[model samples]
Target: MARMPSFLKPPKKIAKRQLELRAQLWPDLNEGDLWSRHTHDGFSTIPSTMALIMSIMDDLSKNKPVSSTYLELWNRSFDEGFATLAKAREIAFHSGFSSERAERTWKDRLKILHNLEFINLQSGASGPASYALILNPYKVIQKHHERKTRGMREDKYNALVARAIELGDISLRPADPSPPPTPMAPPAAPFTFPLPAGSAVPPSPAAVPSAPVPPTGVPTSESSKV
Candidate 1:
């Protein structure tokens, strides 16, 4: 039996997955709700790149778990969308650029995607080179949509609270009516004797004077003051 050479050994299983993804298309994908966020995030600046990426998305539709897309970037033939290179050249002409320029502009947006960590450029041995699509834009845009939805919900909840306060619907119900406030006890009058209808009352008694203390161990005359 002949042993297989190292070069003849098949690449890893993930390599096959990448090859498969390069051939599929996602039919039910929706981005209508995400367009506003796309505009907000300024992904609209690179029309050429946008076109190229969307074409890649159409071809790469497997939508694996986000972890599967960490291959750095993805490559595509310039003719991914068009039937042939001639047609791509025609479209490029209509877009006011040569086929090479349009291709260059689209690939050059790798600079924009670099900071975003979306894709990284790679060179090929021959033919057109490709880049690895680090993250799925669809997934990122989906997260943006999720955040936007949460924000809207929070705003709605806040508005409801504000309206409740405005209409004075405070405390859910009316709060039991507060018991009646506990009746206060009346203050007492100063201690005094009352007079009868025909009898007069006695005057208040005067305080008695205290006697002075005598001098201790002193011989005193009767005339000396103590």
Candidate 2:
């Protein structure tokens, strides 16, 4: 077995030292109205690969930069794996689409995001893009790379892949294919009434009783009458 190289190891000690130096240099940095996830009531986890993801989105969208719009959506998301995009005008306004066509512009960017597979849209009472399921950007980019999608910059994709590798991010890998469904057992035969224990065949029907004949004396009317 070979030992790992020191250069390839993480710089934990250096990072600690840097943090100490930063604290010394700016004592007030952690004080007074600062928002920290530890003390904050509302916060959402954002991916560190967001910059690269945005670059890829811009490339795919051809000059129309949708990164800001994406950020708005991410900001509104509460880490619930999905977001309600019912407030389209508000989101668009925050994303710098405050013109008369603000919502329209926002919707166009959303469509681009959907086409790139960064998010899955579902229509609801709100509108066409009433809800959005945020996808793992790493996986989406990996798929695009595999497909050699048009407008994708190779260098950016390469960097994303390298970053994912460094971070030990397995999200870029394809999901396991689901197993095939188990075949159902054949249906049981139709039910039938069972015969008696000893009898091989079903019992025969009883004979019908015939009408009784008239008495001999009572038949005199037919013999002497008329």
Winning candidate number (lDDT): 2
Candidate 1 lDDT tens digits, 40-112: 4422122223333343332323221111122112222221221122233333344334555664543334344
Q: Pairing residues by index, what is the TM-score of model 1?
A: 0.20
**TM-score, one value per model:** 0.20, 0.68
lDDT of 2 by residue, 1-226 (tens): 5665667545989869977897999977856556655444667678778888888988877788888888788888876778898888998999889889999999999998898898899999998899988888878787888888887889998888788778787777557999999999999999988877898784799999997887867756567676
Off by over 4 Å in 1: 1-100, 126-129, 142-226
Off by over 4 Å in 2: 1-18, 27-30, 174-226
Clashing pairs in 1: 72-132, 73-131, 73-132, 73-133, 74-131, 74-132, 74-133, 75-130
